[model samples]
Target chain A: MTDATASLGSAKTSADALFQRKRLTAFAVPAVIIAYLAYIAIAFDVVGLAQRASGENAVILASDSWSYKTHVTRDNRRGGTTYAIEGERKGAYEDGTRPAWVSGDEDSELVIDLEDGHVVRFLPDNAVAYDVPGFGTIEAQLVDGSLNTNLSDPVPDWINLSDQRMTVTTDAGRLTMTRTRTEVFRYFPGWELFWFTLDSPYHNRSFTEIALGDRIDPDRPNISGAMSDFWNNGMWRHKDVAWAIGETILMAFLGTFGAAMIALPLAFVAAKRFSPFGALRFGMRRIFDFVRGVDALIWTVVLARAFGPGPMTGALAILITDSGTFGKIFSEALENVDEKQIEGVASTGAKPLQRYRFGVIPQIVPILLSQILYFLESNTRSATIIGAITGGGIGLMLTQAIQTQKDWEEVAYYIVLIVVMVMAMDSFSGWLRGKLIGRKD
Target chain B: MTDATLSGPTRREVDRIQDSYMAQVRRRRMYGGLTLAIFVLLMVSGFVVADDRNAGGFWDGWRQMLDFPADVVSEAWEKRANLPGLLVRYFPALMETINIAAVSTLIGAMVGLILSLLSTRGLARWPRLITVFRRFMDILRAVPEIVIALVLIFILGGGPVPAMIAIALHTAGALGKLYSEVAENADLKPVEGLASTGANWTQRMWLGVLPQVAPNFLSYTLLRFEINIRASAILGFVGAGGLGFELRNAMAWGPGRFDEAAAIFVLLFGAIVFFDQISSRYRNKLTEGQ
Candidate 1:
C-alpha cells in the first residue's frame, strides 16, 4: 500500500509537470506572436503607412470604378465644342448629337447641369463657367495663349490657378481652362455606353427591346446586332476579354495535363518499386526537387527569354514547375501502392505493363486524378500571375490598365473577370472531381 | 437424381453468362477508349493553338532555350568573386521577403483559426450566417494576391506592406477552408462538455476545438508559410518590394548585370529550398501523430 501511494504521487507530479509546460506555452506562444508582430510593425514602418498612403488615389479608384465623366471641350485654336464620354473618341457624340442632360446647342450657350445644383456653361471662344452650389460662379477663358480666370487673390484649395492654366474642382464636376482648350468634366454614375457605342444603332436600347422589338438596324436582327456591338464594344473589349480568359484557362489546361503526362512516366522511375536502380531514382527525385525549387517565377523569366511573352510561355513555365511537383506527389503515391494488388495481377499471368495497368493504375487513379484536378484549379490562378509577368491573358490586360493609372474602370472590370474565372475553374475542378472519382465531401 | 435435367440446360446457361459478360466488358472498354481519344484530341489541339499564339514557335524556341541561362551562368562565373559580396548585399532583401511571409502567415493563421471555427457547422456561433462567411472566404480565395498587391501598391506606393497584406488575405481564405475541413471531423464531445460548463462560444472554441485541431492547423500554416515566401517574391517582381524587385531591376539593366541577377537567383533558390526542407520536416512531425 505504501509503495502504491509513492508511485501514484510520482505520477501526479509528472502530470502536473506536463500541465505546467503547457501552461507556460499557452502564455509564451501569444507573447512571442505579439512581440513578432510588434517587430514587424516597426520594420514595415506601419506608423508611417498612413502618411505614405495616397488618399486621393484611393478616392479616385473607388469613385472611378462606379462612375464616369463626360467631357465638353472647346478648342481655342479650332473654335468648336465637342462632347465625349470619358474623353474617348470612340464615345464621342456625333457632330449634332448630345446627351439630354446638356441643354442648348453648340452655337448658343451650352448649359450642362452636373446635377446637385452644380452647372457648367460652355460659352463662345473657349470661355467656360462653373457654378458650385455653395461657392460663387467661377469663370475662365483662354486669352492670348494664356488662361485668365475670375478675380480672386487667394484661391481656394479646390481651384488650382497658375499663370497658364486654371482648374476648378467641385463635388459634381470639374472645369479646366488652358490656352489650347477649355474643358468641363461632368460627373455621372454608372458605366455609360457599356452595351453599345455611339456608332451602333442599338446604342440606347434596353435588353428587352433588343430581344423583342422590331429590328433596330435594317442590316441585321436586333438581338444579334446588339450582341455584336456589345462584343465589339471599343471601351469594354468583351471579345478580347473572352479570349484572354480562354487563354488563361488554356495555359492551366495544357500546363496541368502536360505536366501530369510527363510526370507520370518519370514518377515510375522515381518510385522504388518501379525502378530497380536506386541511383536513378535518387537522381530523378533530385531533378523533381530542383525544378520545384527553381519555382514558376524563374521558369517564366527563363522561358520568356526564349519563347517571348505569350500564353505559350506561361503554359510552358507552368508545365515545367508543375511537372516537378506532380513528379514528387506521383512518386509518393506510387510508393504507397499496395503490393498485394501487384502480386494478384502477377499471379494472373499478367505482363509488366498489364500488371501496372490492372494493379497499380486502378489503386492510384482516384488520388492522382483528385490532385490533378486540384492543381488544374490552382494553376488557373497561377496562369493569371504568369500572364502578368510574361504578358498574356487577362492579367496582362489588367497590369496594362493599372499601369495607365486612369483606367480604373477597366481595372475593376478585369478584376471581376479574373475572380469569376478563378471561381469558375474552382467549380469546374470540383464538379469534375465529383464526376470522375465520386464526391469527396 | 437431377443429372438428366441439369446437364444441357446448365451448360447453355453458363455459355450465355460468359458471352454477355464479355460484351459488357467490351462496352466498358469502348467508353474508356473514347474518353482517351477525346483527351488526346484536346491535348493535340490545345498544343497547336498555343503554338500558334506564341511569338516564337516551339520548334524554333526549344533549341535556344538554354542561351539565356548559359549567358547568366557564364557572366556570373566570370564575376565569381562578386557573388559573395552580392549575396551579402541582397541578404536584407531576402530577409524582407522572409519576414513578409512569416508575418502574413501568422496573421493569416490567426484569422483562419477564427474563420474556420465560426464556419464549421457544429461549432458556428451563428449558424444562419455560415453561407455568408463561406462566400466571403470564396471571394477572398478567388482573388489572386497580385490583384490586391497591385491595387494597394498604387495607393500605398511601392512597399512590402502591400505584399504582406495581400498574401495574408489570401492565406486567411485558403487556410480557413483547409482548417474547416479538418474541423468538420473534430469530436464535438469536448465542445459539448465545455458548453455544459457554461463556456461562451469563444471560450469553448479556444479551450475545446483549438486544442484538438492545433496540430493540423500548425502543419497547414507552415505549408502556407513556404508558399507565401514564393508569393511575396512574386509580388516584389510586380513592384511590392523584396528580392524580386531587386531581381527585376537587375534584369532590366540588361546584359552587363547578369552577375547580380544570378546572385538574386541563388539567394531566392537557397531560401526556398531551405524553408521547404524545414517546413516539410516539421509538418511531417506534426501530422505523423494523427
Candidate 2:
C-alpha cells in the first residue's frame, strides 16, 4: 500500500514537471516573437529616418486627376510646325472636339481643336481646364474667345470630379484649371509611397490644376509614368507588359536549358565514381562551390557590364549562375546511385563508359529531369531580377512604374501576371514529377 | 566418353571447338532496331529542342564575367563608417528572423511529431489517412515561400505577421514530411512491446515511437531553420520587410549605393554560416547524447 502511494506521488510530480515544461516553452516562444516584433518596429523607424534625411518625403501624394497640355514644334529641318497637346478628360472622349483653347498673350503659338480637324489660330498664352458647373467639363478654349467645346464625354460615375484638377501651358502663357480624371484612372490613390522622393518646395499646393507653357513640352518624357495614372503615361498599356514578360520568360527558359547542358557533363565528371581521380574531382567541386556561392544577381550585374544590356546578357548571367548549382546537385544525385548495378556491369568486362551508359544513366535520368524542371521554375524568378537590373524585362517596367509612383492598380496588374506565371510553372513541374517518378511516396 | 562429358579437352579438340564457337554470334536483332529507333526519337526531340532554344549565347558567356571581388571589397570599404549603425539598425531585425525560425520550428516540430506518428502504417488503423496527409504535404511544399507570403498578405494583411505565419505553415509541412519518414524507418521493437502492454495510442507514441526518431527529428528541424532564414529574406521583397527590403531598395536606387547592398549580403552570409555551425553542433550533441 505504501509503495502504491509513493508511486502515485512520483507520477503526479512527473506530470507536474511536464506541464511546467510545456508552459515554459509556450511562454518563451511568444516572448521571443514579441521581442522580435518590437525590434522590427524600431528598425522601421530607423529606415524611415534614413530615407527622410535624404530630403525624401516617402509618403505617397494622393491626387485624383492631373492633366497637362503642351505644344510641340520641330526646330530641326525635319518638318513644318506641328501643334499637338494631350489632355486628360474626366470622361471618355472621342477623337476630336474644338474647345476654346486658351494660351498666354503670345501670338506665335499655333492651337488646334481637341476635335479631329478643328485647328484654331490662337496667339494668346496659358490655357487650363476648369470644370464649369453647367458646362459639365470645360476648359479655357482660348484666351480671346469663348469658343467652349464640350468634352467628348461626361464625368465618369466612379470618379469624383470635385477633387480633380488640370494644368495647360503654351508658348504665350501657362494656365491652371481644375478637371477630373477618367474613372479608369481613379482606381489607385496614394501610389507614390513606393518610390524614393525628394521634397519639393510646392507642398500641399497640389499642382492639381496647370496649363502647358512653352517649357511644358508635350514631347518631354515623364520618368514617373510607372507610379502615376497620368494621361500621357503610356507605359501601363497591356502590350508593353506582355512584351516584357515574354522576353523575361524566354531569357529564363533559355538560360536554364543552356546551364543544364553544360552542367550535365561537368556533373558527370565531378561524381566520385565517374572521375575516381582525386585532383580532377576536387577541381570540379571547388569550381561549383565558388560559382554557386555567389548570388545570381551579382552575376547578372556582371554579365550586363561585360556583354552589354540585353536579353542575351540576362540569359548568360542565368547560365553561369545555374551551372554551378546544377553541377553540385547533379553530382550529389550521381554519388547516391545504387552501386551493385554498376559493379555488376563492371565485373562483366564492360568498360567505364559502358557501365555508366547501361547502369548509372537509367537510374539517375528521372532525378535529373525532375531537378531540371525545378530549376526552370526557380530561374523564372531569377530572370525577373536580372531583367530589373539590366533594363530588359517585365521587371524593368514594374520598376519604372514603381519609380513614377503610378497607380497601385498598375502594380496590381503586373504582380497578378507574375503570380500566374509562377503558379503555372509550379504546376507543370509537379505534373512532370508525378508523371516520371510515380508519386508513390 | 568419360573425359568428353567431364569437360577435359585435348589441345586440338579445344582449338577446333573455339573456332566453331567464334564462327557465328547469336544476335537478337528483332527488338534491337525498335529500341534504337526509340532512343533516337527521345534524344532528338528532347535534347534538340532544349539545345536549340538555349543556343543563342553559351561560349561567349566568359566575356561578361564581372570582377566581383573588387566590387565587393569597395562596397565593404564604403560601408565601413556606417557598419556599426547598420549593425545596430538591422541586426535586431535579423535576430527577429532567427526568432521567427525558432518559434516556427518548435511549433512545427510539435505538430510534426503528431502527424509523423499518425502517418506510420504500423500504428495507425487508417492507412489512407497517411496517403492523404502526404499528398496534402506535397501540395504545401509545391508552392514557393514568396507565393505563400503573397497569399497570406491578402488574407492576414501586410507586414511580418503574414510572413511568420507563412513560414510556420511551410515548416509544418516540410518538417512533418521528414518526421514521418523518420518515424516510418524507426525500429519496431519498443513499439511492439508497448502495444503488448495494452498502452494507449498516445502512450505508445510517446514511450515507443518518439524516442527512436527524436534525434532525426531534431536534425531535420535544424535544417529547416536554415532554409527558413533564406526564405524569410525573400519574403521581404514583397513588402514583407526584412533585409530583402534594403537589398531591393539599394538595387532599385542603382550602383550609387551598391556598397550598402554588398554589406547586406555579407551580413546574410555571416548569419547563414553562424546558424549552420550551431545547428550542426546541436544535432551532433543530440545524436551523441552529450
Candidate 3:
C-alpha cells in the first residue's frame, strides 16, 4: 500500500511537469514571434517608410486607372489652340473638329464645359477664365511673359498664383497658365479610345450600327472594318497585347515540355535501378542539384546576356531550371516503382529497351504527366517574371507601362489579362490532367 | 459429330475475338502516334518562332553561351582578393532579403490558417461562404507578385516593404488552398466533442483542429519560405531594395564593377542553396513520421 501511494505521488509530479512544459512552450512561441516581428519592423524602417510613402502618387495611380483626362491647350506664343486626349498625339482631335464638351473654333475663343457647372474659356492673347461652381469667375493672362492673375489681395487656397505660373484646381478640372501656354484639363471616366482611335471610322459608333445596321466604312465590309479597327486600336494596341499573351504561353509550353523531354533520360541515368554505375549516378544527381541551386534569376541573367534578352532566353532559363526539378522528381518516382512488373516483362524475353518501355514507362507515366502539367500552369507565372528580366512577352509590356507611370489604365488592363490568362491555364491543366490520369481525385 | 460441331463454333469465336483485339491495339497505337506527332510539331514550331523573335538566334547564341559565364568567372578570379570584403559588405542586404521572406511567410501562414478553416467543408464557421472564400483565394493566387510589387513600388517607393506585402499576398493564397485540403481530411470527433462542451468556433479550431494539422502546415510553410526567398530577390531586381537591386546596379556598371556583381551572385546562390537545404531537411523530418 505504501509503495502504491509513492508511485501515485510520482505520477502526479510527472503530469505536473508535462503541463508546465506545454504551458511554457505555448507562451514562448508567441513571444518569440512577437520579438522577431518587432525586430523586422525596426530593421525595415517602417516608420521611415510611412513618411516616405507618397499620397499624391497613390491618388494619381488610383484616379488614372479608372478615369482619363482631355487637354485643351492654347499656345500663348504660337497663337493657336489644340485639343487632345491625355495630350497624346495619337489621341489628338481632327483639325476643325472637337469634343462635344468643347464648343468653339480653334482660331476663336473656345469654351470647355467641365461638367458640374464648371467652365473654362480660352480668351484671345493667351488669357484664360475659369468659372467654379461655388466660386466666381477667375481670370489669368500671360502679360509681359509673366502670369498676371486678377484676384483679391488674399487669393483663395484653391488657386495658386505666382509670378511665372498660375494654377487653378477644382473637382471638374484644372487650369494652368504660364508664359508659353495656357492648358485646361477636363477629367472623364472610362478608358478613352479603347475600342478605336479618333482616326478610325468606327470610333464613337453604336455597336448595333456596326453589327446590324449598314456598312459604316464604304471601303470595307462592316464586320471586317470594325474588327480591324478594334484589333489595331492605336491607344490600346490589342494586336500587340494578343501577341504578348501568346508569347507568354509559348514560353511556358516550350519550357515545360522541353524540360520534360530532356529530363526523362537524365532522370533514368540518375535512378539507381536504371544506372548501375555509382559514379555516374552520383555525378548526375550533383549536376541536377547544381543547376537547381543556381536559381532561375541567375539563370535568366546569364542567359539574357548571351541570348540578348527575348522570349527565347526566358524559355531557355525556365527549361534549365525546371529540368533539374523534373529530374529530381522523376528519379524519386522511379525509385518507388514496383520491381515485380519489370521482372514479369523480363520473363517474356524482351530486350532491355522494350522492358523499360512496357514495364517502367507505363508505371511512371501518370506521375510524370501530372507533374509536368502542374509545372506548365505554374511556369506561366514564372514566365511573366522571367520575361520581365529578359525583356520579352507580356511581362515586358507590363514593365514598360508601369515604368511610364502615366499609363495606369493600361497597367490595370494588362493586370486583368494576366490574371485571366493564369486562371485559364490553371483550368486547362486541370482538365488535361483529368483526361490523362483519369481524375482519381 | 456433335463434338466436332461444338469445336468448330469455339474456333470461330476465338478468331473473332482475336480480330477485335488486334483492331483495338492498332487503334490505340494510332492514337498514341498522333498525339506524339502533334506534340513534336508544337515543340519544333515553338522553338522556331521563339528563335525568330529573339534578338539573337539560338544557333548563334548556343556557341557563345559559355562566354558570359567565363567572363564573370575570370573577372571574379582576378579580383579574388576583394571577394571576402565584398561578401561582408553585402551580408546586410542578404539579411534584408531573408527577413522579407521570413516575415512574409509568417504573416501569410497565419492568414492562410484562418482562410483554410473558414473554407474547409466540415470545419467552416459559415458553410455557405466556402465557395466565396475559395474563389477569393483563387484570385489572390492568380495575380503574380511582380504585378502587385510594381504597383506598390510606384505608391510606396523603393523598399523591402512592397516586396514583403506582395509575396505575403501570394503565399496566403497558395497556402490557404493546401491548408484547406489538409483540413478537409481532419477527424471531426475532437471538434464535435469541443462543440458539446460549448466551445466557440475559434476555440474549436484552435484547440481541436490546429494541433492535429500543425505538423503538415509547418512543413508546407517551410517550403513556402524557401520559395519566397527567391521571389523576394527577384522583386528586388525590379527596383525593390535588396541584394537584387545591388546586383542590378553592379551589372549596369559593366566590366569595371563585375567584382560586385560576382559577390552578389555568390551571396544569392549560397543563400538560396543554404535555405533550400535547411527547409527541405526540416520538411522531411516533419513529414517522415506521418
Q: Which digits, one per residue and each the tens of the lDDT, describe model 1 over residues B180-238? A: 99999999999999999999998999888988988998999999998999999998999
lDDT of 2 by residue, A1-441 (tens): 999999999999999999999989779978986786567547445355343332211212112122223333222222233233322222212233222352332236444333322233333333323332333434443323233333444644422223233333222233333321110011212323122111211211233322222222244423333223342233245556666777667677777877888998999889997787899999998888667545454566556555556566777778887898899889999999999999989899999789989899889988888888887876676676566666666666665555455343455556667756766776787787788677745
Indicate the docking level reached by candidate 1: high
> Residue A390 in model 3: shift from native, Å?
0.8
**lDDT of every predicted structure (CA atoms):** 0.91, 0.59, 0.92
lDDT of 3 by residue, A1-441 (tens): 999999999999999999999999999999999999999999999999999999989998999999999998888888888889999999999988888998875566788899889988888777788888777899887878977777877888878888998888888889988888889988889999999999999999999999998888999999999999899988999999998998899999999999999999999999999999999999999989888888888899889888997889999999999999999999999999999999999999999999999989999999999999999999999999989989999999999999998988999999999999999999999999999989966
Model 1 DockQ (Cα-based): 0.82
How many clashes in each structure? 0, 39, 0
TM-score of chain A of each: 0.94, 0.58, 0.96
RMSD, each candidate, Å? 2.0, 14.0, 1.6
Off by over 4 Å in 1: A1-20, A105-108, A151-154, B1-6
In candidate 2, position A343 carries an lDDT of: 91
The 10-residue segment of model 2 chain A with minimum total lDDT is A179-188
Q: What class would a CAPRI assessor give candidate 2's docking? A: incorrect
Give a tens-digit lDDT track for model 3, residues B190-247. Answer: 9999999999999999999999999999999999998999899988899888988898
DockQ of each: 0.82, 0.10, 0.83
